[model samples]
Target: MDFSFLPKYWAYFNYGVMVTIMISVCVVFFGTIIGILVALAKRSNIKILEWLVSLYVWIFRGTPMVVQIMIAFTWMQFSGLPTISFGVLDIDLTRVVPGIIIISLNSGAYISEIVRAGIEAVPKGQMEAAYSLGIKPINTMRYVILPQAIKNILPALGNEFITIIKDSSLLQTIGVMELWNGAQSVATATYIPVEPLLFAAFYYLMVTSAMSGLLKLLEGRMSNGGKA
Candidate 1:
């Protein structure tokens, strides 16, 4: 009831909000690329590459996400690893890098499955027809297979992005100042837990709902185009 504390500690909340959005966006973009690669390797004839992809996916997917974050963070800290300087901004890679890497790896494992399923759902005849027309394998996947497969996978990818948005909250364990971290800091400063947490929850709800709405609109367009 006493969210009077919100105005007092808005800066911390902003930090948390920014961290979550930045991390989730970077993770989703890079994760999808990594996922596509893994999916391709899974379906490729190269035995050793397929095996390596399997191992990476298995390790990332099977293990707890928090464990990955901690391991990456701890390794970087203990190794005295250097932070990245981007001219105007310096990134503490020990914090942001590990958080992004862990989340991206975890997402890549799951997204790989989504992508593979999408690739499989495309009709085999499509690939055969492209081949008969003398399309290269790369061109077939690029121009023929992927566009159709994306329609089936878009919703699932949106959901994964939502999941990443929420899951990044756990990065507080590795000293990433994400959403939950904002709540915790406000709670500690104000000695009022529920209101700060509720505020954080409101931000999460707003972001996820907006993303869901956009995905629905995209799906509608996709469906309508198919009809036309």
Candidate 2:
């Protein structure tokens, strides 16, 4: 009922917001790279590669993300990371590194499917036309297929970014000090659990809403051939 604690604890939420954004950005970036590779491998027509990529997607997407984080955290404990300072940001690699890796891998599995669908949506004739022009398969994909496919799947990729933003809360369990973790710290300090959590929810809503607006604007520009 009382938000008088806001002034006293705003810094915790601010730091948490920053950490959440950083983790989400890293996850989306690395996940997109992994997904592109996996998608290409799945479509590579080599049975071995397809099988391996398929298995990876199955294991990662089939399992819950929290469990993956736990497993990765435990694994890292044996050979964990040392503290890394970055001016205002001090990273505890033992938690932050493993949290990012596991979440990115999880996002990668889902993204692989999105990318594969995008790639498939491209007309076969385009690929064949490139090949007919003596273009290497790699060059064909680079110059022709991927560009169209990325546009086709831009909405889905944006949704994935939003999903990662929410999922970053799970990193709190590993002591990564993301948004949810920051809320928990404030809850402990303020002795008012529900208020802090409600405040955190407000931040999540604001972020996702802003992201959705940006994506709509981007989609419109791309749809309009980059016109204003």
How high is the CA lDDT of each candidate model?
A: 0.90, 0.91
In angstroms, the error of model 2 at 85 is 2.6
- TM-score, predicted candidate 1 vs. hidden true structure: 0.94
In order of appearance, the predictions have TM-scores of: 0.94, 0.96
| Clashes (candidate 2) | 0
Regions of model 2 farther than 4 Å from truth? 226-228
Given candidate 2, what's the lDDT at residue 169?
96
Candidate 1 lDDT for residue 179: 80
Clashes (backbone N, CA, C under 3 Å), per candidate, total 0, 0
Poorest lDDT segment (10 consecutive residues) of candidate 2: 80-89
Q: Global lDDT for candidate 2?
A: 0.91
Quote the RMSD, in angstroms, for model 1: 2.1
Off by over 4 Å in 1: 78-91
